[model samples]
Target: MIVSLIVIVVIGIWLMSMYNGLITLRNNVANALRQIDVQLKRRHDLIPNLVSAVKGEMKFEQETLEKVVQARAAAMSVKPGNMKDLAAKEGELTAALGRLMMLKESYPSLKANEEVNKLMEELTHTENQIGFSRQFYNDICTKFNTKQQVFPTNIFASMLGFKPEELWELPADSPERENVKVDLSF
Candidate 1:
């Protein structure tokens, strides 16, 4: 009876440890996603100002400007937890912004304008933040998923109803995945 009591105590401690670790990992995954969301929000907010700064100089490229605007709207409308849809919308926005950025290379005045240059720099910085946040989010997701899939932990994880976190990824065919072609020739 004493040996059985010790076995029960040991199993209880192990179960508690697993539960706490899984909870911490799950929360980390969520926090990582929230960081990505914050970066995306910054990007969305910056788009209109950037577009306004360049609108006059790129008068002929209304379609490109409009595409950026529409993409931003679509990205903002998606539910925050829907990673796949949000990623696709953001990809469209990124591609549109990329085209807008390349146009600056063609227009000497836009490149020369201080306001446009500053806004462009801010947008570029925000893009870098977004990229970094996405990588962090994916890393957390890998940890959470691995925790729920490895060894004896897997057995208890499912029993506890902990589900795997999804990693954010752009589809292979996404235009954002394509290398940007910039022409420097006047």
Candidate 2:
């Protein structure tokens, strides 16, 4: 009887620990996603100011500006997923933004404007931060998913109803982002 009681107690403790670990992992994923949203919001806010600043100088690039706006709209509508859809939209938006930046290069006055320069700088910094935050989120999701699928943890995960998280990713076919690389030769 005493041995049975001890076994039960041990099992209870183990289950509790597993549950707590899963909760922490899930929370980390959520927090990381929240961080991305925060950075994305900042990026979105900067877009209009950027567009407005360059509009006058970039008179002939209306098509490029429209693409940027459309891409932003698409990105704004993206939802969470571990698969291709989410990543593709993100890639598209990033590519469009890349195009917009390249267009800016042709207009020296726009590039030289104080407000445009500052906003561009902020947008660049925010994009870097968003990328870092996304990596962190994916890492957390990987850890959680691995734990949920592993042997002992898998049993506990199943018992506790833990499931894998969808990864937050950029669009899969964003050729634009791929082409936006700087020429580092200099």
| Cα TM-score per model | 0.93, 0.85
lDDT of each: 0.90, 0.81
For candidate 1, the TM-score is 0.93
lDDT of 2 by residue, 35-136 (tens): 877887788888888888888888899998998888888777777543365567666777778778776877889877899989888878988987898899
**lDDT against true structure, model 1:** 0.90
Writing each residue's lDDT as its tens digit, candidate 1 over 66-158 gives: 999999999999986788888989998989998888778889988888888899899999999999999999998998999899999988898
Lowest lDDT sum, 10 consecutive residues, model 2, at: 170-179
Worst 10 residues of 1 by lDDT: 177-186
In candidate 2 the C-alpha lDDT for residue 146 amounts to: 95
Clashing pairs in 1: none
- lDDT for model 2: 0.81
| Model 1 regions lying over 4 Å from their true place | 182-186
